[model samples]
Target: MSIMDASGLPATTPDSNQYSAIPTTPSFPPPSRRVSYVASPSLTSLASQLPSNLGRSRQVHDLVRALGLLQDEEQEGQGGRDGDEGRASSPPRATILPPLKVGRKEIGRFHDLDYVDALLSPKTVVSPTNSPTSSPSSSSQSSSDDEEESDSSSSPKRKRFKPDPTPTSNLSRKLLSLQKFGLLDDSPPFPSLAPYVLALAGAALRAAQSVKDGTSDVALCWDGGRHHGRREAASGFCYINDAVLVILSLLQQRISIPNPPLSDPQEEDDRPEKTRKPRILYLDFDVHHGDGVANAFLSPLSLPHPTSSTTTSTSSKPLPGTPQVVTLSIHHHAVGFFPSSSLSSLTAIDTPHPHTLSLPLQVGASASSLKRVWEDCVEKVRESWKPDWVVVCCGVDGMAGDGKGVWNLGASEEEGELGWCVRKVVDWKGGIRGKVLLGGGGYNHPNAARAFANFTSIALGRPPLDPRTPIPEEGIADEDWESFAPSFDLEVPVGNMRDLNSSDYLDDVCQTFAVLAERIRTI
Candidate 1:
């Protein structure tokens, strides 16, 4: 059914275009890669961050690893290759699905790729001397003369990326590629997620390749979820819109991002290439509407693509796909409940700034309601769009039994139907590139985290294991367990929020998009 082959990719080809403005970077000394999770008393036991909500989001990096979503090595080889049967002998994919090779130039490629270039050109290299000491490449203290030269070149260097192809036959390779990018440093709040999103985007492109190879079935791609971000502002603890970027990237690559999927193929493009961009069914299970992602796909009535600089040629061209990425969100909103930020977020909705968001008024529905809503908003897209790929953004907040969920998803003592709903949609038989990605988080709850872990297994067409809550040295005490049992369901009201009024601050942003969830399920 599957096979494993060991062949390195061809030497970096000459066609490797230079997206970054900076010239060949001298390998500078690396900076500290230490990531510290400074937990305050209010957020002590990462699990308790979100009340009946889900688990700590950061836990996903670890849990998925334990569950094998983020393995360093590939496994479960098909009879011969890593993916579905019959993969062509394409060159080994670039080891880094990472965002086009991040450097000063590639980091800021936004609505305007060229503008990003201006920022990253060697002439604009800014001094890292005062940059957020997150992760810095090594450049020692140069003499005063050198400092001046550095300053002359230092004008807030824009980060540039390289164009890399990915292999659709291999999922682990995709994951590894995704993680490598996850480690890069982008501008402010860009956090370490830029590379991750770039890698995920590259991975999505890889999966779409299957459509042409004639061996792929579905496309499943995902990336880190960074909700709480405003257009140009990374909020909700997410620095990069990895989930959205991956989908957009696939579409740009002309990977035929599936709009919505039908049980069978319908209209075929008689043009060159294939439809592997995946009929992307974006499902944001996170409590939020995934505003940044929403903005990327469809600009709200009020918001649209702003006048972008010419440098961003990537943005000018729709890559290679059109309407390839379709998105859907299931989260809590105060439709008519209060002050409407949806309308406010509209002022510049036409402008691309990440604040693009959509919300639902009420989320207190039970399983049936949730399922009906999901299908209404999403399933129909597949029928209409007929996307070749599917990307699922699994947010644990909506999982029943978690605290951050706006609705019970399952009341009357039920375990919740979120996972079941996901399974029902993803379990379609023998689809190529079928995949689900984990995203978003509130108060870190391991249960929510575990639910995500389970979803990854299910997305892979495997059953999930009941996750066990790890205990302390003496084992979790019965009394402690009982005390830890969540009693109330905490929900954020959808309307009259700060994000709507423009008078709002970051802490209350959750209401803007219900914790921003984006899930892409490719069929």
Candidate 2:
């Protein structure tokens, strides 16, 4: 039943073409490479999710191999080949983090605090001027664009005496404590938030390293559902908000690798200013209000940025030419409609000055709500916060009928471009400029395959022009994607998709029919 659009392909039709224009406030890296975070178990499920962890790590490794992210250690050892594949003798390892068991339910953790802050407060805008009049200053900078790559051909074998320097020493231990011990949120005397701060900072450093070299242009990662989590405790599924960690990491890394002022002051004035934290347009379109992400920023910064520290000013104080790093999550209006508590309650900290609302829908929350939310958040924030890079927490549960909060009191078959819509906006934007990385999120096991496929589509566009399947050449005019009446669901329950000779309807939208030479060249 899928129909092609003016672009000659399946199009995700939203309620309206409201926020389709390119966002000026938000921006991500130039269509850098699209990296997929895949693991054996594609989706982020399982109590321990151990086996899946290894698979996810493999996804990272595979991309690295394909894009050559890491140095080739054995090019010389095994002839002068590229050593891109089939060079490893041992099996890959799983990143199975010990299942976070709280009572009977398996939970998730948030290793980074900044990510937590950003989620909770998406609209804390910052101007992109270097060494601005107001803000926190830092030191001990790491090499931002300075890195040396080992030659693939005769990379020397060194002793195992090398130590992997962690930005924060206690990070891994605390990650263990934060994950396994579970006492992290409460200000336990000795334990440090430093670990998570550094873990995320290290991640940012690594990403920066990746960018400095020609290794990676775009990166996608799904992490830390921390809305329910608090400064002192794990709420919902999050243990240590990793998003905050990344943000904080970038901040710390920026400090460590000090931003030496441009030699030319006029040059700095003349050119587009770079952000301390990659001006990231962190967009989350899941049905749930990316509450965790929104909360992080909204929550008063532990050590407030200068902007956070200053007296709140008028929105019209002449916006900055460039944007500093920021997070913006538009959600279904929750003021009086739902959550009972006023939206202000969630905005206890520094919620975006004027939070956007997706509002409860009339026809019981059709797919349009999803598209609206995406468009609105991007558009509203466009003038204020265009990111240098974008990170999308791809949560598929909101496709149609969702359980964990979409503001829809009831459920409905969210047909048409359900997940397709989310994929389209990000993918299309990526096609033009900036990169969009897919990070798995909030899903149950049975639905994992579809989620993985969606991510696959995002990474590799439109299913790679299926060679086996031919496009309809007859050019029927005007039927949209859902027009074919893809009658059957993924669970069509046995029998063939359609009886070609019987003149019966084709129940299965994705059905693969077998035909002889007669069906072919019939055009």
- lDDT string for model 2 (1-523, tens) is 2233453332334211111111112222222233322221112221122222222322222222222222232322321112234433311211111111121011113333443343223122112221111122322222232234455689643211111244343333333333333332322212223223223223333432332332333333433323333454444444444454444433332312245688877663444444443445555544445555555555233322223556333353323322234454433444543223233222222223322212222223434443443343344344344444555555444432233434221111122233454444445442222443333333432222233333443443332212122212222123311221233112111112221211121211102111111111110
TM-score of each: 0.47, 0.42
Model 1, 217-325: lDDT tens per residue? 3333223454433334433445445565445544443344345544457766454534443446565656656655665666332212323443232342333334445
**What are the runs in model 1 whose C-alpha is more than 4 Å off?**
1-58, 64-223, 227-231, 255-279, 299-324, 335-363, 375-377, 400-404, 410-416, 429-436, 464-523
Per-candidate total of colliding backbone pairs: 127, 70
The candidate 2 region of ten consecutive residues with least summed lDDT is: 514-523
TM-score of 2: 0.42
Worst 10 residues of 1 by lDDT: 32-41
lDDT of each: 0.37, 0.32
